[model samples]
Target: MTHSPQLWQPLQYGTAEWQRVYFRLRNAIEGMNGFGKDPLYECLESGGTHRIRGIAAQAVLVAFQLAHANKRKLATWAGSIAVDGNRPHRRATRRRKTKPLGSWNHEGYLTEPSE
Candidate 1:
């Protein structure tokens, strides 16, 4: 790792905490992206949905769509929390356990057996 150029935007690169933080953020981003692309929801992939001529218009429409998505997401979150305030906490899933490798020791090999 080069020390001269500090890792900005994300300070931690390969550390354990960095991974945990980034993975959580990635999950949220992917969830929102999926929500935006879904046909029943935002239909962001379809140009006909916006039907706008200029970049400014399209940007405004997209901004509104994102706001709508955020509203829907917030409502769903609030409803879930209201319904089951005492919801059971999920346990951390166990990592796949691999068989421990057997220790091997090298010994001198005789080319020919002693008479």
Candidate 2:
């Protein structure tokens, strides 16, 4: 039998640490793509005929979307600041519901609900 020396590399693709780093980076890129498509934020339209043509125009559009996303994020963070400036407001996972002013009764009269 013949023996051969193996070369050592710093970053092994199959390693746990490398996988974690790779996944994190991949997730970040995916998140950015989703953010760009968000209606409330960048609202980037990918379908149909594009208003701006050419590589330069597309690059400029992407740049503007990124800038808008950054601005909106900053504004949200700024608004979250507490009155005493001690801590930021916690993000609400669910939306708050508002009560309707009036409802129709048996007589078809619009009146407030009886408690």
Candidate 3:
């Protein structure tokens, strides 16, 4: 079957699906230690607590709604941002050079070291 290559599809939820998914997500967050009891209570009453909780809860809600509307055939996708080895490396230690040190003359010109 062919599917639309769009991400703006509408999401919906019905029955106890929202409650189930919400609790599952809540449990996962609680397990992570990032969501304390206070935040959980706050989320139960206001959809979210802290900034992270709010953002995660919003994403979970959207996913739950999509899953519910699409049922078993629904396709849900998630991805994480990653750095692909593009960062520059910083030296952890300074290396000592065995070569004789060069000298800078009074005029600021570098000169070969005298034997």
Candidate 4:
């Protein structure tokens, strides 16, 4: 067994397919976390707004919050894909500056998904 398993994985980890798949999945997760923590959208931070007590109450609150967040995300996505006349036009994606890290991005991918 290797002393550090992370450094030993040298298979198909550096391929473009790997980067695209990993980044798409990772962006979804980070996007949700950022959306939930956003001040204008949600108040998920500690000592921010709510003062509810107990685990059950907190869980319920969070569940409802996430549900609302989902609805908002869906609405925003729909608006982005809104059609004009008879044609269905997709929203243009913004181009990002080149990052020093791999295609997965440095800030978003806190850790490797898997090798």
Top candidate when judged by TM-score against the true structure:
1
Candidate 4's displacement at residue 111, Å, is: 52
lDDT of 3 by residue, 1-115 (tens): 6657663333335437667787888897665333222342223234333234467777776555444434422221211222474544333668876543446667867787579
Report how far residue 37 has shifted in candidate 2, in Å. 0.7
The stretch of ten residues in a row with the least summed lDDT in candidate 1 is: 102-111
- Candidate 1 residue-wise lDDT, 39-93, digit = tens: 9988988887998889999999999999998898877676555344576434477
Q: Look at candidate 1 and give me any clashing residue pairs.
A: none
- The candidate maximizing lDDT is 1
Better of 1 and 2 by lDDT: 1
Off by over 4 Å in 2: 1-10, 48-50, 77-85, 89-115
Model 1 residue runs over 4 Å out of place are 1-10, 83-115
Candidate 4 off by > 4 Å: 1-20, 84-115
Candidate 3, overall lDDT? 0.48
lDDT of each: 0.77, 0.75, 0.48, 0.74
lDDT of 4 by residue, 31-85 (tens): 8988887787766764555679988988888888888888888887877664765
TM-score of 1: 0.60
Clashes per candidate, residues 3 or more apart or on different chains: 0, 0, 0, 0
Error of 2 at 26 (Å): 1.5
Considering summed lDDT, which 10 consecutive residues are worst modelled in model 2?
1-10
**Which residue pairs does candidate 2 place in steric collision?**
none
